[model samples]
Target: MADKAPSGRILVVDDEASLREVLTIMLQREGYDVETAADGATAQALLRESDFDLIISDIKMPKITGLELLRFVREHAPETMMIMITAFSTSEDAVEAMKLGAFDYITKPFRNDEIRLIVRNALERRALRQENQTLRQELSQRYSFANMVGKSEPMQQVYELISKVAPSKANVLVTGESGTGKELVAKAIHFNSPRRDHPFVPVNCGAIPETLLESELFGHEKGAFTGASGQKAGLFEVANSGTIFLDEIGELPASMQVKLLRVLQEREFRRVGGTKDLPVDVRLIAATNKDLATETKEGRFREDLYYRLNVIHIPLPPLRERSEDIPLLINHFYQSHAGHDVKISDAALRLLLDYPWPGNIRELHNVLERCLVLGSAESIGVDCLPPQVRDAAAGTLLHDLPEDGLDLDAYLAAIERELLLKALERSNNVRTRAAELLKMSFRSIRYRLAKFGLDVDE
Candidate 1:
């Protein structure tokens, strides 16, 4: 017998005092602290006095039945687990007892093995559920700072910049190519600052129409317009003491830009039909994929508003420029869906790295997910990619290069170097695989590796 067991309290209830004593003694021998009750009313009274981990009760009693005890346990002590015992165990009563929250039902004269197994499994389940909840809480704490996820170098810089400016109450402009997780950065700045726990509203400038933009930002009074139903609070008013993320700020209409600039200069705005000004306390975090500077020069965007929003600028590099980050991002996504038998092959991963990602990180994540859903071989591969990417790879590998009037020897060597690079890439940087593809001995390939500035390890 295993000496070690988890410690918990048990309450035993039976109409017969001898049966109650027997069960209490059995549980106490099994290492559980035990208590006894003569009837359901007594058990209910005991529950009001102190907490117990488990309850074992008889099905039939004169004052209160075990079924009533199960209901009482469910209502009064929801945390405590219960088991029932009965000499006459009908199928419906057994099922009904379970549905009403009895952990298990034991018929008269049950084996000790049956009793031990049921109790052990139920206790283990309770412990396992608590352990799982603790792990999730710890994970959430590590992943979120101001409700944002960023551990890479680019994100570290963003973190520093956000910290520096979030305290000053400056109008911040966040610029990033689309799908670069800019909104996540915005929320982090807002939640980590002093205005945390307040409303943090988000509005898309491009998503809302120009005619309704003013109404959405500054709100409207009852009967303000043709379809006016009642007074509505604007994002600026609702987000008082917090922040508003104005996404795609470059898409704001030129006319609305003047109104936005006025609000930035002063801390107030009037409703659409009301004359009185509404005072607001808001921190603005704006993001755009467009070039606001060029738009300013072209008279499409206001110079004054552009400069105000650019007080603390944060620019996110496109995915191609941050190719080194793919592995990190892949692992992050992997951990989010853990315990699955998922993996990426070296050849498939190398193909992902080599491709110039036009749609950025978002596209990469989508592609990998699709491959997992569609693939049967358990690994993502080059064949899994779309035709456009395959075509691009083919073109790059065979493109004509400048000869520069080199001698025959130099020209041939240059060609060989290019071919070696292509071979290594096709084999996921495996020298042995490259040698097999090139129809050359592995030793011969190694000897020629340094002449072309190629490392066999690469």
Candidate 2:
């Protein structure tokens, strides 16, 4: 679901300058920001001056061998990635390098694509470890909370409640914004509690209609409904010894809400149009974005049902509240967007930090995907952005631009041409919104797009 790849620096060392240059070029072609050294000694000196995400060195270097460098990396730069390179092509060297903490190994005359893939894979592993650390940190932040990503004060309260009731069979109600990742918290509780290995089945209460929601939650005998040609086990039956996540619980219709409340009170329910009362042994974890309490007060949602599902509550904050992590999220996306060491400009970083992000984490990711695809160049700039992003960036980082009195006509014209053609390409000669972003909406933009005769869209 996430496309983050490791994108830190890598130290490439070889006794031969030509080989070093070739390797650097190959990696740079893949969007990696690379630096090089001619020998292990030089590589070590660079390590002293800077930190690297990973290292690639020749096994037989001038003074210090790759193995020695690996030893130094293991002790001094424990997190650094060390890849041993050699002409020897012996498994012994590969085994030795790995034992000494080398992330991977490659021999001389390596294909360009192979080198890129290996570095990408190694860096991805490193990124995962770093992200896991972030999750653990969140645990402490959301301390006593069930599994989730944020550790804000609100999350801490949720954590406290989860810890108190996870071991018991009490029902829970988790509330938050739509993208708040509540299901993650539900699984965390089920897995952490006594039913760690038991099944954790989830059902969206809002997705099925009122007439079918009951059957969906409590199974149905054959021909119970128009489409019920065969008997089907309901969610509760499937999750008998485990947990059931009732997502969007507020959307449950009033008729079904009454039936659901009965089950919570008696721990039993009969299938639709069936005479058998089936007892269920399942833990309930329900979540919704609505304030069921307010709905109850307004006589919209049921009060008894609200009380039944509200025994333990957890709420997650929207991503903007955790805006401090925007940079980390940007880096996280950059690493996973399927490229080598794609770097973001400081201006872009500043831009991402200030966006209102109405869609929260989901919007941030969408913006990042657009940027990655369109701005694969070494550096991303304000002009590279979609207009809204550029506008957002300008809003947050506005300053008095000293009148330099320069005509941006040539630059603007070239960009307009590109956008027009891009639009034409997408519509197969039609100019539309997709093309508009590529070209722009100004009269001058349309004029230039015409100048190129790119009127692809009829």
Candidate 3:
């Protein structure tokens, strides 16, 4: 027999003392920790005191019946599994117990092996359920809004829009430059919404061949196409009761756009070459770097479809526009990369900030990851930065010195102070925003301000 410590605990409830003793002894011998209760009332009290993995109760009991106990367990201990004990005369009641969510039932005078096997199956089922629940929680955390790192006003507004629209059944359009974390925002909305327990399906409309795109979205019956061998469920049907994120929606063919519009209008779609209209309940989220309104006006996209998808619009700011958020994002990526002992010099960080990130947050993340893997020094200096960053940093500060020479430290400090003051003025003395504007972390900017005795509130 396997170890009882790993199998989990069980509760046996019956009015008959001998039957309770027999079941407890049998379960314990089968490598399960066992407890006994004389009646449903005792079982309920025990349940309130301590948790059990499985509950075995008699259908007819004094004070509280087994059906009532099932209700209590369902309401209070939903994670626990329940089984019923009944006689041949009350076998019909056991079927009713099954409808009430009983895991299984064992008749009186049943063989010892039969009862033991039933109990084992119920425990196994409970363990599987608990495992799945834990995985779902981990996935939810991975895609939560906390993973989208930024505190800029632009990001704050984005957060507010997401929170407000996530709970609604409206379609959303996310517009931004490529690599602006549009997919991340889509995942955050899906995981935070009511449909989180269901699937969150994503498909890049541009990646799939135009010939196969229709079948991919709506699926097809066997023999529907040249290579079709089996009936298949489409992304929309797979995402029923959840979310479907269509990336690069602007790249969709005009015919597919019309089909998508029909689905949005009627909440139903016919598969490629299939006659039956299949209904779907899905929260649609579309993303594209293209100016969709312009696309609609130019006849490249359907105007009605564009309006249907643009019901809730979220535009992500380019990284250069949110430069103040760079340092925070760097630190976030550093911690994520497990670079506990690594640090980047302020000079090096400034170089990163000065460069216009055409690729946005995604590019920054990739660069940081590269540094963590390739850079050897504990303190990452300007020399350790990528060639483009280093060259840009050096070229920006190149200048001739006067014959008398210059106070380099004081000269740089004065430039720093002026820039800080301007950033502060622009951000209305919000230190966090000022830090973002200067491409420094909140803590780093605060330290510099305090050193200069310029940490004044407006």
Candidate 4:
């Protein structure tokens, strides 16, 4: 078999020409690209010219010492790994070099095996660090505001609110209907905040049984309860210095609400069966599809706790209200799931836009994925959609009217504007052709366009 290509680049720095040559030859034999530097200054020059995965240097050298070179590497290329070599009599210098960011150290009378093992371990650590850094960057980009997929005014407002609130320590309460992406908003805030490096713990208040709620939030000591098994940390303790997202906060029982409020006010809590209070510093982000304010009035939720969690409020608009964003969201999900090769027919796109998405973005994504997977490989047509989506009628819109009621005039106007826009899109923006598509006379279409502030000569 052919020899494997060099896996890592190594720079060997020593004042002794013989030692440098020996170390270089040994590393090169192990399938590493190796370079020799006669002194610390020469090593610095080589580092500027080329990148090295690992650096091995002699602690005792003239002009610039190994410790000095280590410091320089730390400030200039902190990601690069370094190892130091020192005489047994001057081992303390090796210890100092370690403090100065050297990866590891070896004594002068060391075996080649010892050098090889330490060098391999240091290179492995460097590779792991690089991998972790890359993953963090990808996650940051994935949750960024630019990736949220909306250009409507309502979504723009949401993006602005999240940006302003992410840097603060204030608690946030996100209100929206089911499938409106409340958890997504929570993640965007946490990832953009200073606590991005720490854990992002999510707890579903509705999912966990009431009996285990307290212990889950405040952990339990051994024998605290039947299934205690051993001592364990709670979600709050686990989320220290980061973020804890509480979904369906409205579902939290009355008893747990009091304890949660205390934690919010005191910043400390004792374990289920322990005495000492454990201090926790975490940002709280709560989400609920229910009207918490109304729940408080109806005596179902505590008003004080509601105020505490509502320090900052973010209300997400339902998909029907932001219908203009549907096409953008569809394109985003399509590109993400099916790539550019699969296409969605214009007729299918129109039905998707007309359908009242009561399940919101989540439902849209699932439908698109299903179509791409089960439908034709080349295109997603009307037949690819579920019956509910394909047969969606104008009456379905009335079924989702808010409990508080809506302005009939404003609601009808929105529908009319949307239909007009769709017609214009289908007709390639020609007003006369758009009127024909909508089955309206040119005069009527022109008057309606002027009324909606969308008047144009063409």
What local distance difference test score does each model get? 0.77, 0.74, 0.85, 0.87
TM-score of each: 0.57, 0.53, 0.81, 0.84
169-254 in candidate 4: lDDT tens per residue? Answer: 99999999999999999999998999999999999999999999999999999999888899999999999999999999999999
The clash tally of candidate 1 reads 0
Extract clashing residue pairs from model 3: 324-436, 324-437
Q: Which stretches of candidate 2 lie over 4 Å from their true place?
A: 1-148, 155-165, 334-343, 377-385, 393-458
Error of 2 at 242 (Å): 1.4
Clash counts per candidate, in order, are: 0, 14, 2, 0
Q: Give the best candidate by TM-score.
A: 4
> Model 2, 210-249: lDDT tens per residue?
7777788888999887988988888888898889999998
Report the lDDT of model 1 for residue 237.
88
How high a TM-score does candidate 1 get?
0.57
Top-down TM-score ranking: 4, 3, 1, 2
Clashing pairs in 4: none
Reference-based lDDT, residue 274, model 4: 91
| Residue ranges of candidate 1 with Cα displaced over 4 Å | 1-153, 338-342, 376-378, 400-458
> Which portions of model 3 show Cα errors greater than 4 Å?
1-6, 339-342, 376-384, 398-458
Question: Clashing residue pairs in candidate 1, if any?
Answer: none
lDDT of 1 by residue, 1-458 (tens): 76466678888899899887777777777898999989889999999999988888888887988898899889998878888887866757677899997888889887777877777766766677668777655543442453344456776777678778766788889998888877877876775677765778999999998888889999999999998799988889888988989999999998989989989889899989999987888999999999999999999999999998999999887777767777767666655644344466554555566678888878877876666566533455444655554444444544565364313453344446557877998999999999998999998888777654467565
